[model samples]
Target: MIYILYAVLYGLHIAIPFSIRTEWTVLIVIALLRAVLKLGEQRTNHYIAFTLLAIIRDRVFQALRRLCPTKLEGRDKGDLISLITSDVELLEVFYVHTISPICIAFLVELIMVIFIGSYYWSLGLLALAAFVCVGVILPVIISKRSGNLGDELRADNGELATYMLESIRGLDETIQYGGGEKRLQNLTKKTIELSEKQSRLNKLTGVNLALANTFILFFDIAMLALSSVLYSRGDIGFDGLLIPLVALMSSFGPVTALANLGTTLQATVASGARVLAVIDEEPEIEDITGKKEIDFSGASLENVTFSYGGDTVLNNLSLTFPENKIIGIVGRSGCGKSILLKLLMRFWRANTGKVSVSDVSVEEINTANLCDMESYMTQETQLFKDTIAGNIRIGRLDASQEEIEDACKKASIHDFIMTLPKGYETKVGELGETLSGGERQRIGLARAFLHDAPFMLLDEPTSNLDSLNEAVILRSLKEEAQDKTVILVSHRISTVRIADEVIGMDEGRVS
Candidate 1:
């Protein structure tokens, strides 16, 4: 439409001397309308792009939750972060620019061809050929030449990100071991490699752009020459020649936009594929929904065998704990103590036999019910960058201030917290770095306490605490054991001495 308006105004300006002023006024109106439409198109495109980005991020988060701990174990954290952040953001190019432009290019090309061809069928055919070559043929050729370079480049970028993250995280270790220089060199090498890959992709993009421009130039010359020849041959008049030529020349805008996306689309395609992979991944443990909730009367693992990779972690492990008993699990480092706790929590599925609570296999228990019935605390407490109160409230989001304080008191950290300047309002730095190891452990214990589940699994709950703090926490555990089933895992024999029953594991078997 813009091209047609321009051609009419041009014809009027040249052919009608008296109506030149009117032609100028009409051109100004058309220009203003086009600008308004352009602005609206941009706003709509942005709205769609942003909305899709938010949805994509949410889907990625859901995928992460589903794959967590089990399927995501040992996965690259940095790469996953990249996928959720920059890679997903890269899709805005396709959503906003590529999709609409492709459609617009086709539609505009059809309109331009029909209108121009009305003047001369031969000129219309020429215009159609130019659109196809620029919009379709060039993109296909560029994509073929790019091949898997986009995938490789994206993979390299992810790898570099992972390496940088690891280096930063282990910076202290690197400095202490005099490996900083080596790490720097490794990083430099990876950075250079990424740059080289990026450079190659840029070169391909440049080539595609150059070829597209050359084709446009060729088509422009061909259209002008053909129009002139037809006019001289008397098949068409000067108006027919000039108008269609100008329209065809100006109508390459939409197709050119699409032609420019050829190389960039490769990265978008790669990122989309990565995003879909995570969303489609089958979790290691599928949550069974719509099952009857198990009452936490007692729990047992019957002849359960489990393995990690090729190494057996639990071998025919049979154990039972009755309700309202504090069961202590003691083992050396890799003797399946933590693994046993995970099996009970159903973080992993046992290879054989049954892990059951209340005579029902864990596989049949509804996930939400199982979560409500059990609370597991790891040896290393994970705390976010949030207020002390906020971190504790994670266990029970609706817990009252009194409940939080009560749980902290049970963990024997309430007095210390009160002594702090902020008194529970203090922000724990990232990963609870602002607090002592023992303080973080206590906070984790407080979380488990606040959860108030029927069963609690504590792994090295007091490993960082002094004897006095450890004793206080153990005493509280004993007091809580009157109603709650406690599965206490620790390396210290003294820690389990207060338990109603104790089990020892060695080399994946009962010792």
Candidate 2:
């Protein structure tokens, strides 16, 4: 397309001097058609590129999700958010704009160089060598210089984003303690680091681009002079001189734009590496592929031992909880009570021995099916910024409105919810900030009840409630445990008093 366009435009420019070789009407019509065709080609290429990007986006997200189970632990949420949102988005530029255009430009430039060489071999060689220096050598050198800076900038940006998010979440605490100034000072420090790294990256990019422009300009002048000399010496014809000049001038636009795209390309490279980091992470535990479904008749652990780093949390642990009975596990702080709950949920596999439910190995159970068989509540309850009814409905997504209210009533939070201005429709605010700690725990309990699973695992269910509220919630739990296997972990003696069996655990061992 470019070849034909250049040929026609230059032909018209040269032919117009001698009483117009072709009629003006025909030339105008051809020029208009070429313009329209070029526009159509650009739009079509853009559409095709965008379609390819849309397809790749799904695969990228899936890869990130599959890597999540392993990547989540000890990770900063704000950093992950930045990676998924900003860093990943940068790749779209590379996919939709950079990839195809770079290839097309390279092929176009190569063809122009060859055609120019056919006419004026010496001049074409000069242009070809200059193109290589600008397109290949210069870009590689700039990338090496800016690559590390880009990575540093991205890392700093992720950290700054994380800190900002953390600060926002803890704003109330900072205000309460009159630590706003201190927090601001810390944030200022992060901002400074981010600014410094960003400035360095910008400077590097600017220097490389400036150098490329200078080199391109020098080559342009040199090529024009060389072509003029060859023409003056009768070494090349007027057509040869003018055609190569026009071709070089027209084709240099593509490579010049490519040179300017370097900064984004470098950033894209860094983003790609960051994305691959998450995609390549190995999960702590491997899922069982050929495992049968779990039987929730009873749950037991046999000779189990586990540790994090050098600290042993569970060792030679063995216990059994008969089906349809409330089994309480009580221990002091740091006694691995919550860790036991995690093990039951298969969040972490035991280092040795076996954990089984209804005589089927927990390690061998399918994760999705295992989750369907039990409802596990964490100590620190998490709630979305949604209505009370919506939060409760998460326990059983298909639960009717009546069922949600019933579960809330069972958890002893329905009365308080009704007294609120919006009742069950009120937004909980971020992480249930509108509700008290006790309210959040009850909400979690409501979820467990709505889940209607065969087994319920509660980790400190009454940790946040007042004595009256605690007693009411415990009574509700006791009633629910009648037909379900309840594995309870708590530090409060009153909380465990309702359990049918209370097992004492210390330093990861059953006592």
Candidate 3:
């Protein structure tokens, strides 16, 4: 449209020299209109891009939630973070720039060809051919030559991100072991490799752009030459010679945008594929929905068999725990103590037999209800960067201050918390780095206490606590055992000594 107006104004300047004032007024109006259209286009494009990005982000988060713990086990945390952050963000290229411009280029090229062809059939054909080459053919060729470079670049980027995060998280260990220099060297090597891959991609992008420019230049020269020949033969006039030449030269804008997208689109496609892979991953255990909620009475594993990757973790395990009993599970490490608890929690499906609660198969129980009825605490408690009170309240979001404190007392950490500078308000640094291991364990106990579920699964709950703290926590567990079924998993005989019954395990067998 801008080129058409420019052509008409140029012709007027030459054909009607006295109409310069009118031509100037028309030129200013066209310029202002073009500015308004450009602004509108930008506004619309950004609106679409931002809205799509938000939806994609939400979808990615939902996917993560679905894949977590089980499907995401052993997955690289940093790679997942990169996918959710940068990979998802890269999609803006496709939504904002690629989609709209491709459509606009085709439409504009069609209109330009028909309009130019009305003046001269040969010129219109030339424009059509040029548009195909620049808009379609060139991108296809460039994309093919790029040859999985985008995927390789994305994979390298993920690896680098993972390595960087690992180095940062393990910085203290690296320093203590006098391996800081080695860690730094490893990081530098990874960084340089990533940079080299990116440089290669950038070089390909530069070459692709050069080829597009060459195509535009070739078409421009060809169109002008053709128009000049028609003008000299009296087949057309000077206006005809200049108008199509200017329009064809300027009309490459839309197609040129597409040509530029070819290189970037590869990365976007790779990112989109990774994002989709996460969203499409099948969960290890399909959640049972639309099932009746069962009241917690007792749980039993009947000849349950399970494996991880092919090695048996639990085999022919049969055990029963009556309601409201403190049943201690004692086993050596790798003897399926924690695995039994996970099976009952339905984190994994048993390969054979049944893990049932209230005489109902866990898979047949509503997942939300099952989660609400059981509170499982692991040896390593995870604490977020939040206030002490906030972390404790995670067990029960609506727990009152008194309830939180009471739970903390039961966990044998209330006095310690009160002595802190900010009491319950003190912020625990990332992964509870600001607190001691025993303190973190007490916080986990507090969470379990605050939850007050019908069943509690404690895996090495007192591992980090000193003798005095362990005794206090164990006493609290015993006191709570009257109302809740407690499955206490511990290697320490002293911790399990308080339980009403004890089950020993060895090499995936219960005794």
Candidate 4:
């Protein structure tokens, strides 16, 4: 409008030969004001986008926390990574650029129509049709043609990520088995499939852009031709003919933005669906909260029936462990030794039976209290890429350096750590891959030891250790047995030799 005014005022000066200094001053002021408002609009839009992204990310992480260990089993790590990172990021475009752009396009065209109508009503209707075609009708058609492509694209991307992650994690195995070529071929196949899906979506984007520009060009020519005819007819003044034509030409900016949104929002639509799925999902087992804290005593399970969907893993299982005792549970592979420990931890609810802790049902205990009372160690200890001290501190976040060293000494890892150049300050690998299996296992034991809970669940704690280190760790367990009740689970006879009473199992029952 300011440019239109400038054109009008300059035209008047050319015709009337009068000083138009005041009109020029007013136009300059309005132009500067519009620039300031535009800058503010950009900042505000992005501020809203980033703020919303943060809230969404927080909700996604909370949802994952509620679904973890149990519900997350067998889920591809790559899919979760893609959903949390790229998927969440793509939504920024929708918030910052999509919603308001559609509204602005509509309003800008509407106002342009009105301004053109003041010149002639027919010209106003023509402008409306042109705007609708390029902004609304064309984009809607393109989106319909690209129906569900967004979902497929996101899903395929996740699959490729999962495959790549698997390949990388199992690279050692692949090389050992000479399966590297096979894995590479599979990787290539997945990459090609993902690329094909992306290519199809890109083709649609190209078509939409090309057609949008063509429609815009055609509209400009149509408006110019019609206005010239009207000028010859003298139904509208020279100002109406020229000014309305310029307005129509320049006003496609907002509509063009709408046209681009249809193409860019493809990934965002799929991303939004994936993100919302996590947030909206109900956890299989909700965390127990707001209960009175319970002191650790003895723990047991009776008549428990559980399955991993199809076949029963633990059926009609029963066991008991007394306080201040090192009780051993032994079973062959495919038996329920690990699952039994997990149930006691309340990672999974038994289909039909009571898993009790401190003579109270675990389901009735406060999660925080249970965590405080029990230090559960899994077979493979997960460590983040951090200093060795940092990893060990995870067992007790507030544990002191002295406590950490003491715990590591108990696990027979302190001597090895001291031999390192940085000692406890040395950084480990992502997933602790930089360390030997024995080192990682000992670190996990150090964590459990540092926790110093009354009830300890150690699964294959010394599986990676030599006889000397194993004896040292077992002796440490015996020393702690005076203050802690330990469930020492392993198939190794040496591991169970330290137990006060060893329980033997054939299936899920005490045999």
Candidate 5:
């Protein structure tokens, strides 16, 4: 449709030699229609592209969520955040701008070749040969020369994004550790390197454009020479010669548009490859296909063994937890205490042995069903920048207002909240920075209390609190564990004493 309209429009433009012979009204109408068509094409293209981009973004986020779940121990939050937002958004160039136009341009070029052939076979052959030389061959050679650089630029951009996020998040730590100067110097070098890569990309694009422009100019001159020879031969009339030559000249706009595609699509294709890399990544563990739900009142791990890379984290570990009991896992730092909790959560599958909840192997329990029965709170509590009530609702979204308040009170945080002017409705700034360490820990405990799951795992829940706060939190846990299984991890022997049973670990093994 774009071709038919364009060809007729170009033919009419050439037919009216006198400026006044072209009816002003008809030209205006054509201009308006053309504008409308272009607008519709762009709008429709963007609408479909953006919609698909939204799906891609969702899938990228889903992959990240699966890769770094709530129980992820050491991954950087800010780095993951950068990947989801900026890195994913950069990919819109590929879907929206590049693919549609590239397809449209090729279709238009094919139509032009057919139109030329209908006029004169020799002329048609010349145009076809020129199109293949400039459009096909030149682009392939240029892209081959520059494609690796484009890929390198994109990889550098991803790394730059990661670095920026890391620097921002660790600004305070950097300053405290007296490493701010060194880190900033490193970032400055990275920024300069990124700029250099960008400069190289720009130079490549310039070279491609310059080459395409030069080829187009040469093709037009050659076509003009051929047209003049045909006119002199008397085989082609002057009017016929004039019309197609003018049309060809006008048609160069579309050809140039097509040639420019190599420059336009480079960034988008590079970004697309980056996105595909993440989507194609296989997870460390495959989900069970037809796992059954199990009643997990009690659980145990028998000779469980696991490793990350060549270093074993848990070697022949064995433990059993009875129903309605609170177990404390205590050990020196870097022991497999946290690794055990991760295995129980199935965040990492054990290489050998079995983990079961009430004699039903955890691997055979549906993931969603297992999530419904267990709640694990890591050492670092991540609170969104939302109202206090909103953060607590993450534990059990449907909990009534009264239930929330009761949980808060049990966690010994209700009084602190009441002290604030807005109380439960008060906003906790990013990561709950507005509140103290004690407050964040209490909020975490409140979440566990509100969730009221059959199994609860708390890693260093009271590590950030004072004696008074810790005692109050321990008392709250005692009350909440009445009919539930609780696993507590801490270095404080005093904190460990509160559990119904204590398990000590050393060097990735039970001691």
Candidate 6:
């Protein structure tokens, strides 16, 4: 449209023959309108891009939450971080710059061909061929030749991210063991490999750009030659020849945007594939819903069998726990002490027989209800970076400050907490690293106490505590069990001495 307007001002003044004043005014108005429209187009594109990226991130996080503790058990944390950060970021380029231009280019090119074809059919055909070759054929050829390089590059980048994350986390360990030199060398080697992969992709991008430009140039010359022959033969006038030739030359803007995408789209495409893979993976265990809610009375595993791959962790082991009793389980390491508790929690499905709570199969109980009835504390308590009171409140989010202190007292950590300068408000640092192992363990116990559930699964709960603190906790557990069933697992015979009945597990079964 701009090209046509320019021609009218320069030479086609005879055709419109309005006043020269009117023509100039119209030209200025249209130019201003075009600038306004272009700005709006960009604004709209970015808004859409931002909204879509937000939605994509939300879906990724939701999928992660659902797949967790089972499907994501072995996934690399750094790789997951890469997907959330860099992979999604790569797509911002596609959404903001890539999608709209392709649509605009096709529309503009199609209209131009039709207008030129009205004057002469062969000229239309020539223009059509030029647009298709540069916009379609070249990209397909380049993408095919680049096969799998994009995926490989993204994977290597993720591995490099993982290595760097590990290095930062183990910085203290590395210095203590005098392995900094070896660690540095490994870091350099991994980084160099990543650079080489990226270099190959960049080389492919350069080749694509060169070929795209070549195709455009070759077609431009062909357009001029064909239009010149028709003009000389009197089949079309000078206006017909000049207008189409100019339009074709100026019209490469949209297709040019596409041609350059060869630079960023490879990574974008690879990132998209990786992101989609996470969303598509099936969860190992779906949450049990729509079942009758269960109240904890007593729970048992009946002729239950379970395994981790080929290694059987529990072999048709059956046990019963009476309500309101502290039943102790003692075993060597890896003798299925923890695994038995997991079955009762339904973290893993039994291979055979029924694991029951309230005499109903665990599979037939509502997942939320089951969780509500049991408070299971693992051997290693996981604490976030939060204040002492804040971390304990996770057991019952609405607990009062006094209630928090009460639970801490029962866990035998209230005196230690009071001795600290900040008392209950003291920070635990990352993963509770600022506190001793026993302190962290007591916090876990505090959380469990605050929960006040009908069933408790305590896995090596007193492992880190001194015997004095351990005895205090056991006495508290004895008092607390009047209304809750407790499964106390430990390797220490002294730790289980407070229980009503003690059982031994040897090689995945009762002895």
The models' CA-based lDDT, in order, is 0.87, 0.80, 0.87, 0.87, 0.76, 0.85
Give candidate 2's TM-score: 0.90
Residue 195: error of model 2 in Å?
A: 2.8
Segments in model 2 whose C-alpha atoms lie over 4 Å from true places: 1-57, 67-70, 172-179, 286-291, 430-432
Tens-digit per-residue lDDT, 1-511, candidate 1: 4444545656666453235576677777978988998999899999999999999999988988888779988887778778888789889888999898988898879999998898899999999999999999898888888887877787888888778778888988998999988988988998998899889988998888899999999999999999999999999876777778778778888988887777777778888989999999989987779997667888999999999889999999899988999998888888888888898889999999899988889989999899899988987898888888999999999999999999999999999999887888887763345588999899999999999999998998988889898888999999999999999998888788989988889888888
Candidate 4, residues 150-205, lDDT tens digits: the string is 77877787787778778888888999999989888988988898889889988988
Ordering by TM-score = 3, 4, 1, 6, 2, 5
- Give per-model TM-scores: 0.93, 0.90, 0.94, 0.94, 0.87, 0.92
Steric clashes per prediction: 0, 0, 0, 0, 0, 0
Stretches off by above 4 angstroms in model 6 are: 4-26, 430-432
Write one digit per residue (lDDT tens) for candidate 6, span 1-511: 6445444646754343355676677778878988998999899998999899999999898888778767787787878888999898888878888889888888988998897776688999998998888877776677677777876777787787778778898999999999999989998998888888888888888888888888888888998899899999998876767777777887877887777665566768888888899988887666889987767889998988888889998988999998999999998889898879888888878999899999999888988888889998978998878888999999999999999999999999999999988998888774346688999999999999998899999999999999999988998999989888999998788899989999999888899
Question: Between the candidate structures 3 and 5, which one is better when assessed by TM-score?
Answer: 3
- Model 3 clashes, total count: 0
Candidate 5 lDDT over 1-511, as tens digits, reads: 3333334555666443333434555567777998998999889888987898889988886776666553234665544554566556656665555567667657866777777666677777777777776767776777677766766675677677778778888988998999988988988999999899889878887888889878877877877788778878876655546555555655655555555556545555655665677677766655565675667779899999888789888888889988889999998887788878888888888989999878888888888777778888878777888889999988999999899999888778998989987889888873346678778888888888888888998989888888887788788788777888999999988898899989889877777
lDDT of 2 by residue, 1-511 (tens): 3345444655657532223334455567778997997788678767875676566566667766665554576777777777777776777777656776678678878888898898778987988987888877777777777766766777788787777778899888989999989888989998988888888878877898789889888887888899899999999877766767766766676676667666667778878887777667676765566677656798889998989888899999999989889999988889898888788888887889888887888877888778888898889888887888898888888999899988888888999999988888888874346678888899999999889898999988888888998888888888888889998888788888889999999878878
Per-residue alpha-carbon lDDT of model 3 for 1-511, expressed as tens digits? 4444554756666463335576677777978998998999889999999998999899888888777679888887778877888888889878888899998999999999987887699999999999999999998888888877887877887887777778888888988999988888988998898898889889998999899999999999999999999999998776678778878988899998888877777778888998999889887877678998779999999999999889998989899989989999897888888878889999889999999999999989988899999998977899988999999999999999999999999999999999988899988874357688889999999999999999999989998889999999988998899899999998888899999999989889976
Determine which window of 10 residues in candidate 2 has minimal summed lDDT: 14-23
- Residue 413 lDDT in candidate 1: 96
Q: What lDDT does model 4 reach?
A: 0.87
RMSD of each: 2.7, 3.3, 2.5, 2.4, 4.1, 2.5
Candidates 4 and 6 compared by lDDT, better number: 4
